[model samples]
Target chain A: MQGKTGSESWQEVWDKSVNGPRALIDCWQEIPCDPCQEACAQGSIVLSSGICAPPALHAETCNGCGKCVAICPGMAIFLVDRSIGSGLARVTVPYEMRDEIRLGGEAWAVDGEGNYLAEGRITRVSGAGRPGRTMLLTIEVPEEWALKVRGVRGRRKLLEEPEEVEAIEAVEDFAFCRCEEIDYSRLREIITQGEFRSLPALRRFSRAGLGYCQGRFCQSILRSQFLADCPEEDREVESFRVRAPVRPVKLSRLGGEDG
Target chain B: MAFNNFRILQHPVLGEKKNGKEVRIFLDGLPIHAVEGEPIAAALYAAGVRITRLSPHKKEPRGAFCMIGRCTECCMIVDGEPNVRTCRTMVRDGMRVETPRGWME
Candidate 1:
């Protein structure tokens, strides 16, 4: 949780006020994705730290087009126009939830962590793209809650807590690969029993990263596990071997011309 | 809306749900209304239909992880074909899909 949200310095970015609608990017995590930079046509959002870095918003130049709002795969970027009215502002938030709230529909405005702050009305819902990949729900809220509201929850969502996964007793039951249901105990036992030091070897024998995601998620965990097992000057962790048709493809597609 | 309906029928950004050329796909022999261009995984997700695949080793449940067709998690039997990535494959009118229960191995 330490590196989850922004630091104290980021408060300056969040509090940075503008005359019109400004793009607010809440993503502080160092994720290896940056579609938001390309999202802005006015060159408002800049990723000075290459592709993987958090965006640097040039709030002044932003036209509040809400293009970034729709294009952001993270659903993090939003537009806030403070110059709308006296003690009233319009905030554009990317909404992809279950409930159906229409334009001018009443919804509970929620904070960054989804706690309800106040009731707000959807002012402008922009379905901007050819078929917008993401829907931006613009809410007209009190000026005080303009910066506070990040999203809205329907009365149903407001009442429903996300389904929680209950805790089980054993660490052995901890599944390293949710796709394959390969547990830690099985992996550890296999590696220790066979003295398997290689990742590809362990993958073949234990079938940890062979499931869905094709080692995208579990390979890292297995690599870390291998690292934990060793007292070494250096550690060599070779990944799974690449093959033709690397992606999961149907056999029927292989027979087709365009496929 | 059904209590279990997770579909984004109307949203602020996307407006009233207009998925190109409305169609229906069969999932586990049940009719699921879907759009033509969108992948079956997305349609399933909107319908709150998770658990597309199950782990062959232990018979445990699995669902779509990466929406972009790279992962093997969302593989399902589509139109009598086995081991198809539902996340990548678009839903066709009357397309049939079912979880490959025992064949996960």
Candidate 2:
């Protein structure tokens, strides 16, 4: 299984930050959502390539603000501060469930995929009444596990130790960019050779987003897919260069009257 | 988790939503109830009519992915005009919508 897209930088920023708390967004897939970009008050998160692209978190600009946490419809944003103690980091996650949350109690920490990792010490809970209706829970966990732990579960569910298994590897041949006949497996194959770093190069190599829709349908998948495959640092968020005639038009319409 | 005829009645953030004015739209000569002011694609979805068009290359069913007008997957023959973006066009009373068998058609 491949690591999530655009997580390399999240890990980089997360591991080096001696500074106070900062927001770290776990959004990888390109769902048709972009509320997090509009929720940031510090202008740290931006969906540079419109709503189709995942929100890019500028970790340095973020002031550990929780504004983007509750605003996310996907519940993928998190705020972590390793500066709390010598070995403890405080991670705040957005909870939309109505389940009872006991403050100062221990809750089972889970990864992004809901697999129990370790028990997290609940420090505080707030946002009882907020505009977005999302409650934020501050859990203190080992500093090393802060970046991987995304959420905490209540004590109602028995602590069933998850069996060891490999993360599911997507093997379906479904193609999002049907116009170009590019599929996920094909994109992963291209990303592994270490050549697809730029947007135009990826497009030229794969021809996935250059179809009639011009990435209106496949840009999100392509962007997140690239980030997920190549977790290299310093990779700038990329989008396809604008090709005019945004909508499709017949060649006859572009040509001068039949001469 | 709540859905009525595939229409979201209330959302956590969007709150309660009441359909604007109900309008009549014909899809392939069949009467379909639709919400006025909403996109034609939305109305089609509410009516449980997906597969707006068959892709030109593979003849695969292509429906609305991005609700916005950017993606033309939901393009259909609307009011005698071909290749109309149903997601961008607002539903109008007595509108005729046709889902072409193939994009080339």
Candidate 3:
């Protein structure tokens, strides 16, 4: 829960539950989607404020069916069973990763940001009853960690930090027009020095967008960079002129020559 | 074969890519083996042909920046066609690909 929608929300879900176990839909984003509501047979999950609302879970109605877990496009739903034992609990999450976690096998429990938590045993790996591709991985962790542990290490090591590399000096050193090999530094220099008044003039002078791509990639970047420095009143950026034979056609084919 | 360092052996979500029919494409007249229907840019990258074209103005080496068809950075002459978006175009048997010298050329 290091990401948005902290463990407090999950704790709220647990506190509201009446039965043995319930589905905790941790879908934080208010994206317009409602497959989870339609998937639930018991009507436990409901998006009361239209599709662009986070799902409201009726914990009392949810029977840990794990239907929402399979149907959720984001795979944000999980079934948490705190009544499994005194200190241990079962946390069932949707796993789509290629690596497999065998039933009863030891797995390193990981939080939302993939930080290492307590080690847990893979209680179940159920893809049989699931509608689509995601496999339900039921890992039994400490009751305290049930709400915290979101994912498990499946044949892959967890919390391996990436090697640090030296940062580039200027932001302009990064290529802007990849086809023409134009960098931000060059563009900045062109704009600040007032060599070219407009984008068309700059395009002609530097040949930035005239390369193989024909201004498809660098046109937008050029406009943004130009507008950043220029006054808002005269910030009208023009798009590059698109010529015919837009699709690259073979010269031999155009000449009606057969191979 | 030597340039397979960038090739993804296995993806966590996508899994292994099941290659199609094996085909040989000529890159600057050098035979490079590739899977048919794969993007010509991917085939080229697999064979280590990164710099597809030189800039018309500065004559600087340019390779694939955006792997998608949107960026024409990976444009190369394919089957006698200049400025072909290799990242979008799929490879075929005996396909002839050439790196354009410069834009005006």
- Share of reference contacts found in each model: 0.48, 0.39, 0.48
List, residue by residue over A1-259, the lDDT tens digit for candidate 3.
0111324356655764324667877776778999988998988777767898777777666788898897788888888887766688888888876565789989878888887777889988887333346788888888877777778786475355788999988654766676666777887787777755578888887777876667876788787887786756266666677777776566787899973
Q: Candidate 1 chain A, which ten residues in sequence have the lowest lDDT sum? A: A1-10
Q: Write the per-residue lDDT of candidate 1 for residues A1-259, one digit (tens) a residue.
A: 0111234323433454446777777778878777877867887777766688777776656677888788787888777777766788788898776666778789888898878888889888765432445668888888777767888778763456678898978654667766677777787777667766578888888877876567866777788886776545147667777776766655667888454
Error of 2 at B45 (Å): 2.1
- What TM-score between 0 and 1 does chain B of candidate 2 receive? 0.85
Q: Is the docking of candidate 1 incorrect, acceptable, medium or high quality?
A: acceptable
* DockQ ranking, high to low: 3, 2, 1
Two-chain complex of model 1, DockQ on C-alpha atoms against the true structure: 0.32
For residues A32-62, write the lDDT of model 2, one tens digit per residue: 8877767777777777666887767777677
Residue A48, candidate 3: how far off, in angstroms? 1.6
- Whose TM-score is higher: candidate 1's or candidate 3's? 3
Q: Scoring each candidate complex against the real one, what DockQ results? A: 0.32, 0.33, 0.42
Pull out the clashing pairs in model 3: none
Question: Per-residue alpha-carbon lDDT of model 3 for B46-89, expressed as tens digits?
Answer: 88778888876677887887888777778888998777888888
